[model samples]
Target: MREVFQAELKSIGDELIQMSKLVAEAMERAYASFETADTDIAQEVIAADQRIDYLQNSLDERAIDVLALQGPVASDLRMIVGSLRMSASLERMGDLARHIAQLTRLRYPNQVAPARLVDTFKEMARLDIKIAHKVTQLLETRDLTIASEIIALNTSVDKLHASVFRAVAEAEWAESAPVTADATLTSRYFERYADHGVSVARKVNYLVTGEWDPELSAALDQD
Candidate 1:
């Protein structure tokens, strides 16, 4: 019975890793579509979100079953609870990517970011993609160092998000109202995506260390 329970736990961990990889891919493709105004790729990302959602539901059911049947305690219990939290964050990340793709689709021929703010949005997208991949690595390796790196990347993304607002608020800003709205919404999606990555990293840190680091908590609070 004990061996079987251990196997079940390992299965749950494997599922989380799979979800992470899918999220990274979704973000990559979403950005590609956003960068080029490729509706087809954006459609692909929007459809792919369903798969991530399915995985989250399936993983949650399995975790609940383990809790009901095996009655995990101590570290085992922590693993189950933490897995649930991470899965929720991963699912939200997938949704954020879908939101980005949807915005691209809505704008069609026109680009989402105005010419003046294009470089800023591009940088934010780049950071978001990096943060997603780093999240996958952190889940696979459980290396606390990777979690720290994820937090740092998220910090940079936050700065970029703020810069977008500043640009929009300037008196010289000449973009139309629609462009301004798109900029605000798209920048927010990128910022929230990175924020979810940080949330997952915090959960992983707690799972590994058995206690949350004060510095990590502070960084997330600043978000």
Candidate 2:
């Protein structure tokens, strides 16, 4: 029974890594569609979110079954609980990617970011994609160093997100209201996506260290 329980725990960890890979793919395609105004790729990203959602649900159910049947205690209980939280964050990351793709689809042939802000949004997208990939690596390796890198990238994303709002607020801003709206929303989507990456990283940190870092918690609270 103990061996079977350990196998179940490992399976849950494997599922999390799988979810992280899907999220990374979604963000990559979402950014591609956003940058090029490719509705087809955007549609693909939107469609793929369902699979991410399904994985989250399946992982959660399996977790509950383990809790009910095995009655995990101490560290095992923490792992299962932490898995549930990490899965929730991963699912939210997928939704944020889909939101980016949806915004691209809504704008159609027109680019989402205005010309003045395109570079900024591009940088944000780049960081977000990198963070997603790093998040997958963190989960797979459980390397706290990777988690720290993810948190640092998320900080950069927050700075970019603020810069977008500042640009929109400038009196010299000449973009149409719709363009402004799209820029604001798209910047937010990228920021939140990075934030969720930090969240998963934090959970992984906690699971590995058996204690949450106050500094990481404060970083998230500031956002």
Candidate 3:
């Protein structure tokens, strides 16, 4: 019976890693579509978000089933509970990517960010993709080291987010109102994407250590 329960728990962990990978792919494709205003790729991302949603729902049901049948305790209990939380974070991250893709689709034929700020958006994409990749690694390894890197990468993303707003606030920012709206929203989506990555990393840390870090708790409190 103990072996059966352990196997079930392992299955849940595998599913979580799979979900994380799907979310990361969503971010990458969304960034690519955003850069080129490619509706085809943007549409692909929007559709993929639904798959992430399905995974979240399915995982929650499985976790609940485990609780009801297996009666997991101690670290096993922590793993199930943390999997649920991490799934939520991954789903939200997927939504953020979809939102970014929506901006691209909405402004089809016209670039979203101003030409001058394209490089800035590219940097934002780079940081976001890096964090997303780290999230998958953390899920697989449950290494607190990856969690620390995720937090540090999130800090960089936050700085870039502020820069986006700074450009919008500048006197020389002469883009039209529509372009300004795209810039504002695109920046926000990327920022939130990174935030969700940090949240998932924290959950992984808690799953392994069985103790929540105060810094992660504080960071989540603001969300």
> What's each prediction's TM-score?
0.96, 0.97, 0.96
- Any idea what lDDT model 3 has? 0.88
lDDT of 3 at 125: 90
Local distance difference test scores for all models = 0.91, 0.91, 0.88
List the candidate numbers ranked by TM-score, top first: 2, 1, 3
Off by over 4 Å in 2: none
The best-first sequence of candidates by lDDT reads 1, 2, 3
In candidate 1, where is summed lDDT lowest over 10 consecutive residues?
Answer: 214-223
lDDT of 2 by residue, 143-189 (tens): 89998898899889999899988898899999999898888888888
Error of 2 at 160 (Å): 0.6
Over 1-223, each residue of candidate 3 has an lDDT whose tens digit, in order, gives 8898888888888888888899889989999998998999999999989999999999999999999999888878888998998999999999999999998998899889899789988998999889989998998887899998988888888888889888889999999998888888888888888899989988888878878898776654263
Colliding residue pairs in candidate 3? none
Better of 1 and 3 by TM-score: 1
Candidate 3 clash figure, as a count: 0
